[model samples]
Target: MTEEPLPTNASSGVVRVGDTVRRPAGPWTDSVDALLAHLHAVGFHAAPRPLGRDEQGRQVLQFLSGEAGSPDPRWSTTDLGAVGRLLREFHDAAADFTPPPDAVWQTAIPADREDLVVHHDPAPWNLVRRPAGWALIDWDAAGPGSRLWDLAYAAQTAVPLRADRPLAPTLPRLRAVVDGYGLDDAGRAALVPMLHRRVTAMVELLRSGAANGRRPWARIWTEDGPYWQRTADHLAAHTDDWAAALG
Candidate 1:
């Protein structure tokens, strides 16, 4: 069961092997491996099993079998229900797993915070869609963080609706995601403040990167800064709207 001849991209450092994918280790690689091992020990099987490093010193793992969504129109129109279900499964699987002692926090801006085992960057490409539902990948950023962190992060990455569609259609998408996660009223209500903070930090990161002479990275942040700002503005302007949706 070798991997299919899929083209590699900049965002993922995946290399193919017979029925497995080998990823070169980085600063956080050892921590990710330990975390994945712990997860398997505790019976969470959705994540890849750490098979060990390859001859090239790349970290190897069992390849997940599923269809990957291309960044095409069809993928953009993915049903909200599927997204919700996938998130719920992830949260459920991730629940009750204590963070490893050396688990390094990687998601969001570098901040001093409490430790909780969290999947920091649970974006689309980091997810694999199987018939049963979705499974996550790229555990590099998984560490101690709040469940809201994952939720808010997902909301920010979701595809926006076309101009002709009702404005803020992504709001409904957000709701569907929450409903899928089955968060209680209190948890949902708390999301308003966090939204602004998250978006603000993202904008800052991108802007700083641009100013630091990382031209390509800087351009990405500069381009995306406005979107993050708009989302923050929307959340600020419509606190009540956000509350209603969360409720």
Candidate 2:
């Protein structure tokens, strides 16, 4: 049997070949490779070094030697400070470089047209925990978008189902996340509504992607849309309650 590299929540396929990892090839693979290479060259040694392609033409990357998966609520609560700081570090490091010419990136058609470099899918599975620090993995959807895009997504995914902390409790966490990244109030406020928009868009994207024959993407898109919508609806239904939580 082919020894699969430990599975990750990465959007593309990820497999291990000896010590190297082979990821799915896409439009932005080259661009991400170049970005990774540049990052390594400039003293950012935390990220995996891009190693070109595997025998099957898949994009090859060095595996990060540590634990990586979705954030669990038990651990996630304790991890806020560390994760917030780590996220800030990434935004600072990544802000210095331009995306490579051939990097395959995803763009969400959000209502308005404000763009920043967003790691659209910041799922827990895309984060790696190493002795040195937390390493952000999976650069597939890295492109121009909003900081809140990541914040809203992360906040939604990071909450504990039974914690009963209300949306306001998330306000400090959200602010902590934004503050650590050095963004302003305007940017933070701008993020709230987008959360709803993103949730709504996710549902639509999944439905559309599946209808159009993008099967693999369709499945997850379908799953994510409704999942996010439920969260959006919760926020909408309990606006005063959620707003208090956000406060």
Candidate 3:
């Protein structure tokens, strides 16, 4: 009966209520609900099932029993591989989904291509580790996107392409994810560039949000804008190195 707030930097007003999660709804809710429905219909169960809206008009979803935003130190190579495979499963399952006629999306950052709807933000923080398996939460960002576009962001956070960390060690983790996903040559070649673009887009989003005094984003920018900018610069400078590592 009591609403317990969920921890995440990507969105606000998300809380747990019994066996479901309730979050602020928007014009994009219908489209996201449809996307999740399709995924489950196709047998992709790594995501929370949409349960329509609550009395308060907030979107409700299955309250997955697991921990969110677990520390990276606890993540093993095997866990990273599972994350890759899970992402691949979600992408493949989503490929055949057709958006509703009047579909609206929360396209905070424009996608590289609108191949299909995807969990635009598939970072570790959104990933939940359950005893049975892992599940990705926060489907509010689900909408038009490409596999590489999604995967690039996943790798950026999961492999954690931070300016503070050494690039060499992270490369193997990146490779593990790619291998788990079974990426093709073209996908491999396109990954680094896409990663650079994704990170750059995030930096721009934070910068613009901060400039315009947007809620949450502005706050996030104030707290971590410099880190994102530095990460974007690091990714841009080492694009070739990242590509080579993937090869």
Expressed as tens digits, the lDDT of each residue in 107-190 for candidate 1 is 545522434566766666676788766677777667666677777666555433222234465567667766767778887877
- Superior candidate under lDDT, 2 versus 3: 3
Off by over 4 Å in 2: 8-12, 76-78, 101-116, 160-172, 221-225, 238-247
Worst 10 residues of 3 by lDDT: 68-77
Query: Compared with the true structure, what per-residue lDDT tens digits does model 2 show for residues 1-247?
Result: 2647556532546777777778878777777777777778777776788898866798888878787755554344446556656665655566667765545555544424434455666656677789998777777666766556676665555543213456555655544544555556566556667656666666776777778867554776655555555666765565444343334
**In candidate 1, residue 152 scores what lDDT?**
69
Backbone clashes in model 2, listed as residue pairs? 27-104, 28-103, 28-104, 70-124, 70-125, 116-145, 167-245, 167-246, 168-245, 168-246
Give RMSD to native, each candidate: 3.7, 3.5, 1.4
**Residue 177 local lDDT, model 3:** 85
Candidate 1 at 182: error in angstroms?
0.8
- Candidate 1 residue runs with Cα over 4 Å from true position: 1-12, 70-79, 111-115, 159-165, 214-216
lDDT digits (tens) for residues 103-167 of candidate 3: 99997888999898888898888898898788898888888989999999888888878888887
Cα deviation of 84, candidate 3, in Å: 0.8
Model 1 Cα displacement at 21 (Å)? 1.6
Candidate 2 lowest-lDDT run of ten: 158-167
Q: Give me the overall lDDT of model 2.
A: 0.62
Q: What TM-score does each of the candidates earn?
A: 0.79, 0.79, 0.95
The model with the greatest lDDT is: 3
